[model samples]
Target: MAETLRNTLKAERERLDLTQAALAERVGVSRKTINTVENGVFVPSTILALKLATALDRPVEALFQLDDSGVSPKQDT
Candidate 1:
């Protein structure tokens, strides 16, 4: 099985005019974590994902996507 993870964290936050610090405060994470997430350098855990979704007022699926592309090519195809 393969998975692809896509996040709209930065876009959504920007759309709402939220700074990374503000988002981190709302999500109970450090600003560095939010920065890492926005930069695609971190893949959040389920709990963190839920917190982000809650803070953004969006469903988890809207913020994250799991698809074939997330896996290695050997696993995906």
Candidate 2:
């Protein structure tokens, strides 16, 4: 499996008291896009990620991270 992009978009958005529609407007995307991202149904583009971080007043790394669940097990050499 490919590494998944984990995010704390929903928590950050709530921390800032912004609704999905509000955050989407700030990022120039549809609310559905934000919802999908929050639900891990979509991986946002780098630009989108930056926009979200900026709007949420957070670093991109704070909002997103790589999950280790997709890592393959090491094989014997």
Candidate 3:
């Protein structure tokens, strides 16, 4: 089955005026990972997803979606 991970990371980060590096530091991940996530090249693990949502001050559901009608479907996570 396919899933759609819709993240407001870029939008939230920009709203907070934070760089990807800054977000990465807060989320305890490499900037490259954040870049991949923001670009939809990587789907974060559950823990990583929670960390990112926490850093962005949003709920996990706001950062990641599972339904098919939302963002484009991704290959498996």
**lDDT score for residue 68 of model 3:** 69
What is candidate 1's lDDT per residue for 1-77, written digit by digit as tens? 53447688999999899999999999888999999987777889999999998888999989887656546566554
TM-score of each: 0.79, 0.87, 0.80
Deviation in Å, model 2, residue 27 alpha carbon: 0.6
Per-residue CA lDDT of candidate 2, range 1-77, in tens? Answer: 66788999999999989999999999999999999999999999999999999999999999999897868788999
Off by over 4 Å in 2: 70-77
User: Which pairs clash in the backbone of model 2?
Assistant: none
- Candidate order (TM-score): 2, 3, 1
Instruction: Flag the better candidate by lDDT, 2 or 3.
Output: 2
Q: Write the per-residue lDDT of candidate 3 for residues 1-77, one digit (tens) a residue.
A: 56667677789889889999999999898999999998888989999999988888888888777556645657897
> What is candidate 2's TM-score against the reference?
0.87
| Model 3, TM vs. native | 0.80
For this target, which candidate reaches the highest TM-score against the unseen true structure?
2
| lDDT for predicted candidate 3 compared with the true structure | 0.85
Clashing pairs in 3: none
Per-model tally of clashing residue pairs: 4, 0, 0
Per-residue lDDT of 56 in model 3? 83
Off by over 4 Å in 3: 70-77
